[model samples]
Target: MGTQFLTDEKGNKTAVLLPIKKYNKMIEQLEDLHDIKLYDEAKRDDDGTSISIDEAFKIIEEKRKAVK
Candidate 1:
């Protein structure tokens, strides 16, 4: 929602920014993708509600492979 200036070890700065609404939407999309993968893996049954970021990416990779 707000902008921030990040300084690297070399003291170079870059502005990072995002709108809160957009960020929330991105989070929701990631969560939905994770839920689908968990369901596929049988690690969740009948509407389970939590997922780790790592698990999400693994699922994403699997999905990507399938598409290819």
Candidate 2:
């Protein structure tokens, strides 16, 4: 496994540690993402909330309407 520091346009930094295969997979997925934001949200426990892809889309739609 290897570790690397990644910097954003704004000079923010992130440290990622992964095996070569995992790193390549991440690179492939990141290349497909036009914009990606990484953040930490508050949670009550280590095993936090879980939602499926369909549920995520529904939540996005609900939030989008409130912004309109």
Best by lDDT: 1
After superposition of all CA atoms, the RMSD between model 2 and the true structure is 13.1
Relative to the true structure, candidate 1 reaches a TM of 0.42
- Kindly provide the TM-score of model 2 when superposed on the true structure, using C-alpha atoms: 0.30
Residue 10 alpha-carbon offset, candidate 2, angstroms: 49
Off by over 4 Å in 1: 1-15, 43-68
Candidate 2 lDDT tens digits, 1-68 = 46666778887886556688988888889966634323232233336567777999999999999999
Model 2 clashing-pair count: 0
Q: For each candidate, what is the lDDT?
A: 0.82, 0.70
What tens digits encode model 1's per-residue C-alpha lDDT throughout 1-68? Answer: 46566877887886556788877998999999999998787763535676888999999999999999
In angstroms, how far off is 27's CA in candidate 1?
0.4
